[model samples]
Target chain A: MIEVAGLKKSFGDVVALRTVSFKAEDARVTGLLGHNGAGKSTSLRILYGLIQPDTGFAKIDGVNVSQDRILAQSKLGVLPDGQGLYQRLTPREHMRYFGRLHGMTEDMIEQRSQELIGMLDMGSIADRRTGGFSQGERMKVCLARALVHNPKHIVLDEPTNGLDVMTTRKVREMIQELKTLGLCVLFSSHLMYEVSKLCDEIIIMAEGRVAAQGTPEQILATAEESSLEDAFVTLSERVAQI
Target chain B: MNILRTIVAKELLDGVRDRRSLFSAFLFPFLAPLFIYGLMTLVIQQNTETESITLPVINADAAPALVAHLKEAGFIIEAFEGDPEAEVAAKTVELVLSIPIDYQKTMAAFETTRVTIIHDGSRNDTSATVRQVRNLVRIYSSELNALRLVSRGVSPKLMRGLQTENGDIASDEQRAANFLSFVPIYVLMAAFVCGLGLAIDQTAGERERRSLEPLLINPVSRLSIVFGKCLAASIVAALGMLITLGMCLGAMLMLPIDELGIRFSLKAQQVVGLIMAILPIPLLASSLQLLLGLFAKSFKDAQSYVGFLVFIPVVPTLVMNFLPFATSFWMYFVPVFGQSIMMKEILGAEPVPLLAYPAAALPTLLAGLLVCWLTSRLLDQERVIQS
Candidate 1:
């Protein structure tokens, strides 16, 4: 499980995260819904200890992220906003590299990489260099790279931002598969259909603050709206008024 | 240790596969020595070629004997039908030799005679010709004086009691040192230039490609990452300098340095010694480049800073070359400066002091370690990450 409470971060005079709080439980998919600059990325970066928050704390599997970063990070899989892939390296190399950084042995790395390659349906391009790969193929490599150590918690930032429809469906399926395996999966997105279809709970954010958090049906009922889209707009405009 | 190994292996493989980095790491080192060799050959060729001197003779009929003597001494005498001074001023003639009309009468009467040699003093090659003509005339006058002394039954030794001869101490090897003085500068510059591409690519290039964030997100200490990258850069730099050293040695062997009357050759042992002497320099170069590259905002910015940073190692060499200072034992403490002086001493066949070796190498190794530590610290800063 991933838990964040009172997370606040500011850059100079601008606050990127303001009193943000949320919880993603095990065996469920929780979607962080926000528009651009709504602090979804910032919140995730803080959770992984890439950036420190001015106030509040984050924990992964009961380990405090800021105090014990290495231990907390070891128990979590993170796909940062940037798809940082070495173009000259193949999927297997990327997996081995990340696995080693996570302190896994060689045999463990190889076996985990093979399992990931098979699970992600990446056998066709597993050994191919990633220089000119399609968006879907690149996403698979990144996903496999993140899951190489099989962490209990997985965090993704806009995983299907620019993917095609088929590729987006593949990513949704992967998220469903992770959920079925009883892993806590937290991801950020602005796509309503994906959020409604995949997330058991939703955290809707507006202007660096969490405006509402609950199941899709609960968010709609609280906002007195018919669809998740209306509920998001209503909550966002209500926070903007405040 | 595992993290470091993985990073180093990846950096080495990535650097080798990058064609642009490969060119900087492997190809540019050879170009420097080959370029210097070509320039050296051209200079030596132009200096050694022999050419006959030309002098326009005025009133040739009045001094046939002197004219014959000048011709025999390898002066191509041109008969002047016009004013010789005007011909020289017009740049048509390099030199003019004028003999007075009473030249024979003056010789018979044993009177002092005046001869004129007019030549352009501004031309570099004209000085040799002027000196040659002056010497020939002086020799002729001395012979006449000796003959007159013989005719008078008075020994010429009475007029010239003391004789002085010069014995110069310069050997061919010592003279060759002058031509090969810039070897250390080129080799040191090669050390810096070889690692430039890899250092910039691994540091600023990683940031520009958005890979550093992901890499840093892994559960590894920042020191391991920086050290791994620096070690890979140092290895690439060291290998490049080794190749450059070999190529420089080959260039030295191929050039006919003997034509310059210099018995110059670099033996295998000396080459090995030189390599050992410069062992710490590549590490220093790579670490410095890594620090500067990481500080800069982008790859282009890092490359620009590195371009300026190269002058740091070269400044000492330039100062030493242009304004030669007396080298002392204390010079071995300065990084590039020490290496430059040591290499010159080694190549010039001068004995290297036993203590000078470590003095030249230790400081740079320590500086490399310090800079690498500083880079790792910088990696944790929020500004560097955001930038």
Candidate 2:
């Protein structure tokens, strides 16, 4: 499980996050929803220990991220905001690299690689270099490597931001599968439809603050809107008024 | 330790597969030797050219005796009737020797007559040949005076003066060592050039590709990651330095250095000494490259920064070449300068101080570590990751 409380961060004069809080429980999919420049990536970055929050705490399985990043990172599987891969490395090599970084033995890395390749249906391209991989193929490689260590908490930032329909569906299915495996899966996205479809809990952010947090039904009831998209618009407008 | 090894292995594999990185690593080792060979061959050719001069002579009939004397002196004489001035001015020949029309009459009367050597004063290539011809003429003039004095019953010894003897202390090996001084510089250059691409690619290229954030997310210490990359680059650079040294030795062996009146050969111990002197440079070079690469905003920016960094090795060489300073004990503490001076001394068969190796290498290795440490500190910054 991942828990963040009272997270505040700023870059120079611009505040990236302000008094934001959320909890992503195991066996559930939680989505941080926001528009562009709405601080979704910044909040996730702090949670992943990439940046320090000014005044807040992010815990991965009860280990404070800021106090002990290595321990916190060991429990976290992250497909970060920038999911770049080595062009010359094959998918299996990528898996081995990350798996080794996570302190796995060669045998364990091999076993995990095989399982991920099979699960992602990436067997055909497992040995090929990723230099000219299509967007879907690249995403799969990134996702496979992220899951190589099989951490209890998985965080993906905009996992399907620019993917085609088929690749996007593949990513959505992977998130659901992780949720069913009793893992705490947290993702951030600007797509309302994807959030409403995949998330069991939603945290709506506006202007670096959490505007609302609840289940889809509770969010709709609170915002007095029929669709989650209209509810997000209403909640953001309410924050703007404040 | 295992994490460091994994990072190193991954970086090495990535570097090996990059055509650009491999090209950068191996290109200088091959080209530097070929360049040294070409340069040494040109030097030897120029030296030999001066030994056998072809002199174009005008009015040869008026000075047959002098022509005979020159031919005996090993000057290849070619009789000519054209304008001596024009021939030399056009560089059709190196120089022209014009015997004046009154040469025989003046010689019979024992009067001094000028034999004009028409040549371009600004041309340095023919200067040695001109001096040889003038000396031969002076010898012939003095010989004629000696014979005249003997015939007149005047002792030729009366004209003798104090004789000056030349004392040249430089040995043939010492002279040859001067020609081989560039060998050390080339080997040092290999250290800087070979690992440059990989160093930049691993640091700044990672950032530009946006792979750094993902890589950093893995459960590894920043020091381990930076050290691993630095070690990987240093390994390539060290290999390059060794190949360049071997190639330089081979090229030196193939050159006809003995024909240039110099004895040039490398002792087994001296080659080992040269290797030891330059071995630390790769570590220094890659660490500096990695440090500068971290500050760059992109891969191309890092390349520009690294391009300027290559001049570090060359600055000391150029200073030693142009504004040479006396070798001091403290020079052994400087990195490239120390390696350069040591390599030259080894090639020249001079005994290096026992402490010089550690004195030179330890500081370089330490500085590399310091740079790697600073890079690790930089890695912790959010700006570096996001930039």
Q: Which candidate ranks first by DockQ, i.e. highest?
A: 2
Model 1: per-residue Cα lDDT at residue B136: 89
Residues B1-387, candidate 2, lDDT per residue (tens digit)? 999899999999999999866985798999989988998898777667643477888888899888999988888888878877887889988888888888999988989888888889899777778888888999998888999899899999998977779686757766777778778888888898899999999999999888999998888888889999999999999999899999998998899999888888888888888888899999889999999899888788899999887778777767878996777879989988899888877877777997999999998899899999999999878888886
C-alpha positional error of residue B387 in candidate 1 after TM-score superposition, expressed in Å: 6.1
lDDT of 2 by residue, A24-126 (tens): 9999999999999999999988888888899999999999999999999999999987559999999999999999999999999999899999999999999
Per-residue C-alpha lDDT of model 1 across residues B223-332, encoded as one tens digit per residue: 78888998899898888888877787788778888987787877777777799789899888998899988899878989999888667667876787789888888889
* Residue-level lDDT tens digits of model 1 in A37-128: 99998899899888889999999988898899889989989887767788988999899889989999999999999999999999999999
Consecutive 10-residue window with the lowest summed lDDT within model 2 chain B: B45-54
Q: Comparing to the true complex, what docking class would candidate 2 get?
A: medium
Cα error of candidate 2 at position A154, Å: 0.7
Off by over 4 Å in 1: B51-175
